[model samples]
Target chain A: MLNRYYRVQAGPEGYLPPAAASMGVMLPEKGEALVEGIIVSEEEAMQKIAEKIVNAKNPVFFPGPNILWAWNDSVLEKAYAVNDLVQSSGARVIPMPDYRPKYPMINPEVEINPNHPNLTIWHNHIDVCVFVGVHCHYANIALKIIRGGTDCYTIAICGEAGHEDAMISLRDVSIDTLRRLNDVIKSTGEGLK
Target chain B: MNKGLVKISPCFEDVMPQEYKELVEKGSYGQDYGVADLGSFKELIEEHPLCAGCGLALSMRLILASLPNPESTIIVGSTGCSALAFSQVALHNIHSLFGNQNAVATGLKRALKLRFPDEIKDVVVIAGDGATADIGLDMVMQSWFRRENITTIMLDNEAYANTGGQESGMTAEKAVLNMAPKGKNFPKVNLADVAQVAGCAYVATCNPAKSRVLEKAVKRAILAAREIGPTYVQIYAPCPTNYKLKPDEVLATVKNREKEGTYPTGEFISAKAQELFESLEGGSK
Candidate 1:
């Protein structure tokens, strides 16, 4: 194995003299390694180091066994780009976004003011709908609303299951997605365009 | 528009009574409950708007405080929910392009060691599986291989949940993790093995269900980083949606995952919990 490594040849500009070997590769006038008739350059060393770091593990990546979950309906171009860069830094990534938008679809069994119309939209498309500020969790339902399959749009989404309970369903990204995937209609008469 | 006499409230806190405002201070249920430990959850989301989901999205409150020093700290996030952790910080933080966290983290670490190796702050990175396994794998390998002195915690949920649960490199071999079927595949790359081979001497794996174990791992990683070296850990967190488990059944499923060794809680090979997971290769034979 060592012979294979040493047999690569460094001659003339590629040969490594004894003093140069002791000093960790003394370069010739060409600024390259002259060992076994083969030359190694500074740029090659940097690339090797870069490659090494790209494969190293143990940089503060994640706490453990967790992913960054999204609420669905995202382009994820930037996410993929970033992932391409960091895995080399030795951390893992996880996502948890789309567990379903907090749509305010109250159970019909519950007796509430039927006249109090729900004001929310459902969206599910390859693009963002409604507005840019709409949250992504609403993408699926927003898609549902734009299809006109149901009445009473405009509902709020809340964090689910014993978590904080509230009623404001305007996820930020639904608007642009809605615009892209469907036609834009005037919002409810409460002054929200 | 009339000269803007809209009469905004004096203190937003005043609109809500002290009791309601105190909600951010009081303790609340966490993983044990169907909800997160939302006392910090609300504060984090309120403070960091770009925050992502569930635990990873909102865990920054704990992570920020856990960092030995925050004021001097420069945070970097790769491609996962961890990226959102610092994203909300509109100031005093740096968010690098994805997959370069290991690289960025290395730069920060080297700059720090050169700058204030005496008394410096931590460089915490929130990375994801795809970022770690494929996209950023090279950078990660480089950092630990050089022993670049950083603390890395890998959150391995076995699938890519953020991008609608795509199959990541960490997904179990011959198991279905991605919701959309890419068909069954095998030979899930053992990140621990890769880390080990890449020269991560101090490595550990822990389950989020076991927070104490996780906390200890955090401490160990931090200490290792402080020693001017790199430390690696793989975390096994659970996902209610991707796991195909009901909301109520998440804990059991998480526990089951740990017991079944799909997530491999404990040390990866020779670190601390070796005896617990030595024959741990999921019977690939």
Candidate 2:
């Protein structure tokens, strides 16, 4: 059996809405939570990060869809070995699925979840119909088969250290990769875990 | 077609006929004839669209209907269904790139002011809360700071409906919404407050599901941006896909949100930026 498992840099910040919204409770702002740091406005900043990704000698990985959960230690080990194997086979190692968690105090307004899930599902509220599962039965299934939004996932390099994986939030992605991943997940019904 | 009928903009009318006036006022017709005649228009639209269905169609129509000129409105959008849909529309209309919708609209508005000072038009920045609150926050601020005459509408469908229903700033924290970091734990940085402080002259919120409220808010934003300067408006557009409910529930959700003041859905006249819009009549504003 494949015994599918996942890695966790941080867990998907699950069931966090009301506690975050309530007064006196200090939760991360929506903006601060999505990315590791304040949004980079200057091109130089993005360039600097991009350069880091390109220059990293170590293998790169994709973060989970969210911040709270990433993967279990065992699953992550498999992934790291896979990366090493792929690299040894003479395939160019791509720095992807890197995540940068925001730390509090230093960048206090939005703090990082020190303990998040293995597959931190990095979803977006603006586009992918978050209310999907509860409101409509066929939406995800129908949308998944078509390779629509949230149907697939990918990898990026933002804050992964060594074999540790993380998802870097890129503004856009390649459709080919998206379609391929969707096909795999659609077949399994596991949702890119 | 009824023999006594005189066509007036599909479902809406110019003047009320005594016999049919009540039917019209009572919201008789839901579908329209306008959609049929445009050959391959539906097919073409269906090509790249993300199944937003009629809601998005009417949304663009309503926004484009009063465009001083669609060509003049240089749209700036971040990555969302709205952006993709706008890209599809741009095939026929004049549009700029994806993302940076607010930034582009700001520059376009400034260019219009500098080049065609007297041309009363708009440069709309179409977007979603995920873009506005999460990614495009700074862009919106800078546009207002520059005092450019443009309008940016941040359509809040609660969650990040495009990249998979994740949490957004506009999504009330822990409202049983999506996979958020901690839900909006911190008080939402009141966007209107931020705009006012940033020197915006007008800010408003509306749900187009309520056509009158939407039209009124949009009209105000357009006027403010054209006459005075840049403005911001947030629309509570619901996402059944994310919410996992029927599309029509959007109206009820929006209404409840409005009543609770969780989502501020009204035209706000900011004192700074540029005084374009008249202070809404009375204190009712």
Candidate 3:
């Protein structure tokens, strides 16, 4: 399945367990609970996301305005947690090119359009792509385009319901959710080390 | 506007942006796509820089998706929040001076008609209410009066949102804003009615809250303008930032306004446009 989807060579360790395929379950009774069109617990989704990031040869984090725009201190803390997650996972961060800086400094190696994720992924040779703090509609558009056009495994950390197009999407993410994901990635990275 | 024009050369396919490659292969250029097929295909507009829960962004997304022929469509935009998003759209868009979108579109459409007399080239003018109903009202009306072959769409946020939330001609009566400190003294300019009176073949008033309805209206307006005459679609995309409402509260505000008999949504088709739609429907059946 990985050979069928991915064009670029994956990490030396090979592709991690197929997150959606490994989960033996039908669609959730409530559609909102679906991650990658299947019902998966939030913890399980986070674990799968961490595994992909930890195992990816070239992982990139594309943070949208929602993550970087700090209207208050809580949002700023969430932004910092995102940065920590990127650092722990050793993933490069790319912000929307048109974004005017607001708060919580982000050092983006490159700029990407949230609507055209495939261009960035193809240019950067990213094997695993994560999107956080993006508006739901824009994220939906980007994830679909990435799935249709590229081989990168896409993850959407959404503030609302999870995205069906992403490989593993964490829904209703709060600051705590960000910290927990970061911790999980950190532990997984430490174990690998 | 030829579909073949977007084809990537085999030699440059590896280096061309993946987006261009996908657009040629999977985009809804000549395909039958609507809001229902959103997540399954490559959308035209790329990432937008509008505020979260912006009604204008949502409306633009729906409108772009509803275009009957995107490959041959040339969008004419003016200075506003819509212009910010226009830069990222994959289509050939012209961002002329503020309030001069109609004038530019008129020239572009005429020139395209002369060049591609055989092909269908859609020239769409999309601008904010300030540009449509105030600063460029005369030009917009002139285009309608001349029966130019173009579709004019208004992203009516009701206020000059990009300029820090000032009052526009489309602002509702008694609405407080930066310019209208106390309140707007006049009622919102009914651009739909004006378009009807000014000899538009098709006129529709819609909001982003009703996606399917807005989609049908956009399709009808664009299709009507192609054969009938100039058409207009007024979209009541409420500005969440200027309205001092939460981002998620935009749809609810639109629904509430509709219920209160304030911003109603309706459509008017001239006799010719109605006949054209009937003939097209008959052929499809």
Candidate 4:
């Protein structure tokens, strides 16, 4: 029998609506629990990441398939805007391998999978890694690479709840949230100057 | 601020920044409409890597130029030799995974309509026969069944030309190909008739060598899709590399193959399409 399977539905990352919106969660009835957290709101986490970036010597940003999931021209512009906000703060932004990057921060040699060849090279030196809209599975692998190799701080900012190991799990992921976060960072950074 | 939640930028018009409105209207989201001069139209398609006299390339060029509203049209492609030429095509193009252009187009069309209800956006899928007829048959049928407003054009080169010319479901019987060393055993899948039966508002089978007929069929298909729902045009494009024929022989192969129950040309407008066309004509008059 020929099996024709296409990903008609979005992956875990695709299920996220904006943080302010209510959505029914789809859970597996008979599997090990996938999500566990301290229940911090998404906004507080963004502020903390902003503070961390302001203080940290080395910070890296990893963005995932959320851009592709949105798939609208306007959505793309928004994604780029968020990237710009992070970039202006002097953070090294890396795009998910599958997603086309607006900037050249993503190491094309490194893929999103666990066994990427460049993962070993980036495993140790970074002080903090801020994950924005990365899939739960990839986020876990990234944690493994960073935690196993360095005493690095990890933060997750996402629409859905999954990254159990993140020091701060900011759960609200919507474009509105990014806009507010951008405003705060822009003001604070400019205030310091 | 929802610090715990990581928010991305919103592209939805309601949430997107105001400055982007002008960008969307200025054809930044899609490609410019290349010149429409017949016989010697300026090429929207730059030089491509396809073999010389590749019928699929010719058909794509014609279809790209015949989009009717290239500025507002988004072309979705799937994995095939046809997709290889997409990078060079000036129009806003997307290459989704193999065998899923229809599904992608369905989502894209619906999204565009939702975002711009006042504007007319054309979502067209141009894919190879294998993607449309074999692997993507289910999605293609589903889109037609849903009556999605989109146009799908299949550049049918008979076999799976990109993957070393393997025998596809659309491969003609007795045609020897990679996997069918002893000649293909089954007849071509009746995709045009399938589209007709599946309630596609307009269906046509044309060849690139007959540019006028192909262009008319494409134009009609696009126009019909605006009001009459899904439309399909399957062009009999030949693969010279796969067919083991000289580059110049591609046109003749499509033209002469009709005697063997292949490459039938003409339009098949459903009753709904006919009604829609009449109403449009009446309203204009």
Best by lDDT: 3
CAPRI quality of model 4: incorrect
Compose the digit string of candidate 1's lDDT tens values, residues A43-143. Answer: 34223323333333321111100112111224233223224333333332221111211123322221111111122211111111111112333332332
The positional error of residue B107 in candidate 2, measured at the CA in angstroms, is 2.5
> Would you list the C-alpha lDDT of every candidate in the order shown?
0.43, 0.45, 0.79, 0.67
The share of true interface contacts that also appear in candidate 2 amounts to 0.00
- Relative to the unseen true structure, what is the C-alpha lDDT of residue B50 in candidate 1, on a scale of 0 to 100? 27
Across residues A1-193, which tens digit of lDDT does each residue of candidate 3 receive? 3232322112221223233322342323322334455557787778888899999999988777665544356666777788888888988776652332211222223566654556667788889988887887777676766766777888888888666657677778888888888988988788888
Alpha-carbon deviation at B235 in model 4, angstroms: 1.6
Task: Indicate whether candidate 1 or candidate 2 has the larger lDDT.
Answer: 2
Task: Provide DockQ values for all models, in the order shown.
Answer: 0.01, 0.01, 0.01, 0.09
Chain A only: list TM-scores of all candidates. 0.17, 0.22, 0.76, 0.62
Lowest-sum lDDT 10-residue window in model 2 chain A: A126-135
Q: RMSD for all candidates, in order, please.
A: 24.6, 21.1, 19.3, 10.4
Off by over 4 Å in 2: A1-193, B1-48, B52-58, B66-68, B90-99, B114-118, B181-184, B270-285
Candidate 3's residue-wise lDDT over B38-138, tens digit each? 98899987577899889999999999999999989999999999988887787879898989999999999999999989999999999999999999998
Expressed as tens digits, the lDDT of each residue in B57-109 for candidate 1 is 33344444344333345566777655544554411355667688889988887
Model 3, which residues run further than 4 Å from truth? A1-193, B283-285
